[model samples]
Each structure stands twice: as structure tokens, then as C-alpha cells.
Target: MKTCRFILSSGLMLFAAAGFSQSDSTGLPGDDFSLQGALALFKRSSSVEEFEKLLNTESSNVNNLDLNNDGQTDYVKVIDKFEGGVHAFILQVPVAENENQDIAVIELEKNGNESAHLQIIGDEDIYGEEVIVEPDGDDAGTAMMMPSSGARYDHGPAAWLTRANTIVVNVWTWPVVRFVYSPSYVVWVSPWHWTRRPVWWRPWRPVSWNVWRPRRAVYARHYVVVKQRRVVGARQVYRPMRSTSAIVRTRYSASVGRYRATRTSTTIQGKNGRKVKVTKTKVRRRR
Candidate 1:
């Protein structure tokens, strides 16, 4: 009886591990474009015009989306909007004769001469949520500090958790971010429309999900996804102009919606020798 029980428990553990591995690796249509890659490219660009050119280049590998279903990668354009020291660069692509879909937006705000915040937000229609990626590294120190009220904390992790609720990544030291905040800097907007694209730009066939999934590791190391928006004012200015491709939007929503519905819960023993209820979410797709 003891041997049989051990075998049953081991098999169940193996089954759960396999499920987790598959869920972690499974790629969705939205996974083709990497926001981390976009943020990294933006850091390297001197201006938004140069950024747009780099985004469309086949070798860049940042953009692998065919939103228009035209059998070629779509050309992404950059439009910079400035208001009250905030610079919001909108990344968009034309999918139809009159419709232009927004892929993402890079928002930057300069608080002082040497302090600034930056964040890149992926469109919900494309990413299935308001996916925001920002540069994070100083949070460990920032979280240890007290609140603006100068309150006292008895616990260290509690203090860390309190200040961590609101994280503002300062990217002023970043070369391109500093350039944008400089007095000599001018707003950059792509000259290319549906009729005009960069002469050097050549769209290529997008790679398979299996090939593209591993490429994210390059940019994933440098950035982190945060729940809060640091540049709210700049993002607010873009509210009226935000748009998404209907074709891609519908497909992404359907694929993501199905996955969200397949959640199940089970009780498992924790390291503390206590039972904890955990929910497992699995994706279901039609063959």
C-alpha cells in the first residue's frame, strides 16, 4: 500500500510539472512582437525618425508582425507628441486604406535636469492587456526607504512592500532619453505614410513562433514588466489617438480569451507543511 501511494503521488507531481513547462513555453500570436526589443532599440536611437527606420529593418528582429495579413512584415512608424515636458512616441502601422493601428507607445517624462522616467506600453488589443515594460534596477534600494510622510517601519520587508507599490524608473542617464530631454532636441515624427516608406526599409517574412520565442531572451534580461504607469500625463495625451488593427485585435482577443477560461484550482502542500490552494491556467486552442 505504501509503495502504491508513493508511485501515485510521484506520477501526479510529474504530470503537474509537465503542464507547467508546456504553459510557460506556449507562444501566442501576440508573442511575435517584443516590447523589450522596442525599448532597447529606442535607447539606441538618437531620434524617433531613426527609431522608425530601425524598427522596419529586417535584421532588427524587434518587429515580426504581419498585422495586415499581407504576407510581409508591417512597417512601423514613430510619432512623437510633447506636452508639459513629457515626450510620448507613438508606434503605429497602417493596416488599411484609412485605418492605422497603434502597436505601442514610449512615454518619457523629465522631472528635473538629471531625473526622468520612461515606460513602453503595448496595446491591449495586441498584447491582451495593458502590458507596460520599464527599466527596473533601483527598486531594491528605493523600496527600503520610508514614505514621504517619514513614518517609521518595524519590519524591513513591509517597508519594502510599501514603497514598492509605486515605482518610478529613472532613465535620465540613458543616452537617448537624455538627448530627448535636452534643450536642443526637436520632436521626431516619421515622414512616411501609407504611400511613402523609407527607401532602405525592406519587409521580410516573419519567423515561426518556435523560432521567435527564444529570441526574447536577449532583451528580457535588461527590462522588467511593471504594473504601474510612471508617465501618466504623457499617456493620457495619447488616449484620443490610441488605435489597434481590427484584424489582429480580433484574433488576439479570441486566442487569449479561450486561454483565460481554462483555469482550474487544486490544493498542494507547501514547504511549510501546510496545504495551499493554487490555480493553474492552461491554454486551449482549436486545431
Candidate 2:
């Protein structure tokens, strides 16, 4: 009930879920900072204060934002985890809503940790340690700064995006699972990665994760530009909305300074035979 359930294209739906973990993942730092340990602590935390204390200890840095405008910070970030070829991201606030907010549970292999490309976005296999989660979708996908090259790479756990530097694309409001991670810094993750089956600690029946939420702001588009160690531009534009379910896939032609979104949807005929939906998605890539 804590999740803000909005109408998915149409019709408002409500769902709740819960689960917990007392186990830890090996092969990571094997310390409290590891994803598994953080999950263990979040599951058993008796109070919000205690959960945040655990988060502060495990993360190298934290990004604070008032997601609902309540003026109280709702999110605390952690490290990234890879399980069975998918990245399992854990955010603080261990509850039924946050538990189900997770889209995938990853299981990691012992020796393959370093070489694992957690996912192939836009068909490019990106290593797990290099991804970033930009909460604001400000064109700058969450990135890790490589000291050797002085360049940042787009690494957030998003769906349907091109490889690093091709032109970062996200569905703005559509949810894609992501872990708050930094390559050079310590991170906390979820033990959900260890389980192959869905955990049933919820007091009620579980529902689908598709109602699969994206961890960061998934409703807009951003193209971030950083030049000379400074962010020159970061822009977020809303995606085209429709009355029916649709999927928008976008490709950027860097030479043209524009983003073209090809949206596909099915329209239901009303009594008047009116089918309502956005036939096209057009957003100018801000410079």
C-alpha cells in the first residue's frame, strides 16, 4: 500500500508484497559493505534510523532526494550486484513495497565476478562494475568516473539503452531495475540476488513486478554532456503518453541533435470508434 500505484496506461491498480533475507553473498567484499550483508541488515531492521545507519556504513557516498515532496528523504543507495547474468539492485527501506520494487534477483558466480557483463544494453555487453544510476535522468545516466581516462560512462541498470556513449536513452517513467553502485567505492546490495525463487514473506498474496518498476526517474529522457570535467548540459524531456499500453524505443542520431522515438501501441475502439493514443514520440535532444 505504500507504493504509489498509478494507472498503467489506463485503470488504476494496487498491489503489495514482502520478503526478507538473513543470508549473505560470498565472493563480494565479504564484509558488511557487501550486498548480502546489507540485505540481511535491512530485512531485520526494527526502525528506519537503524536501516539508514547500515546504509551509511556500506556506501561510499549517498544521494539524497525528496521523491514525493514530503521533505523527508526516502531513498538511500548502495553497491551493485550481479547474479546469474542479471544485476540485482537493493535500495534501502526494506518493506513489502521496496521488496517487490525489485524486478530481478541475481545469483552471482564465484570466479566470474570481475569479468561478468551484468547486462547487454543496446546490445553492448557492459561489465557490472561500470554501470551508473542517474536518479534525475538528466541525460547523464548514472556513471562511474574512470581516473585513467577522465571520462564517465553510462552504467545505470536500465532497459533498452545503447552501449556506453552511443546516446543514453531511457523510458523516463517506465521502471527498470537498478542498483545504486560505484566501481571504486564500497556498495550495499540485496540478498534477493541469491535466491532463484521468489521470496514469500509477504502477509498477503504476491502480484507481478511488471508493474516491473524502474528504480530511478523513468518518465523522461535525458542527454547529459560533461566537458572539461564539468557538466555542460543535462536535459530531461517527457515521453509521449497514450491511453493504451505502448512501448517506446528510441535511437539518437548524434549528427542531427534529435531523438526519434518509435512508439507502438494498441488502441481500443470506444463507442464512437475513437481510438486514442500517441501515434508518434518526438523530443528534441537538448544541447
lDDT of 1 at 272: 82
Tens digits of lDDT, candidate 2, 117-219: 2111110011111112221234333322222355333433343233333333232222122222224323344343212212332111211222212211132
RMSD of 1: 9.4
lDDT of each: 0.71, 0.25
Candidate 1 local distance difference test against the native = 0.71
For each candidate, give its TM-score against the true structure: 0.73, 0.23
Residue 44 displacement in candidate 2 (angstroms): 28
Number of the top-ranking candidate, with lDDT as the measure: 1
lDDT string for model 1 (58-162, tens) is: 777788888877788888888888888888899988887677888889988865545666789887666655678876554311223223445443342223323
The list of candidate 1 runs beyond 4 A from truth reads: 1-29, 138-162, 165-168, 259-287
Off by over 4 Å in 2: 1-64, 77-87, 92-114, 119-280, 284-287
Q: How accurate is candidate 2 locally (lDDT)?
A: 0.25
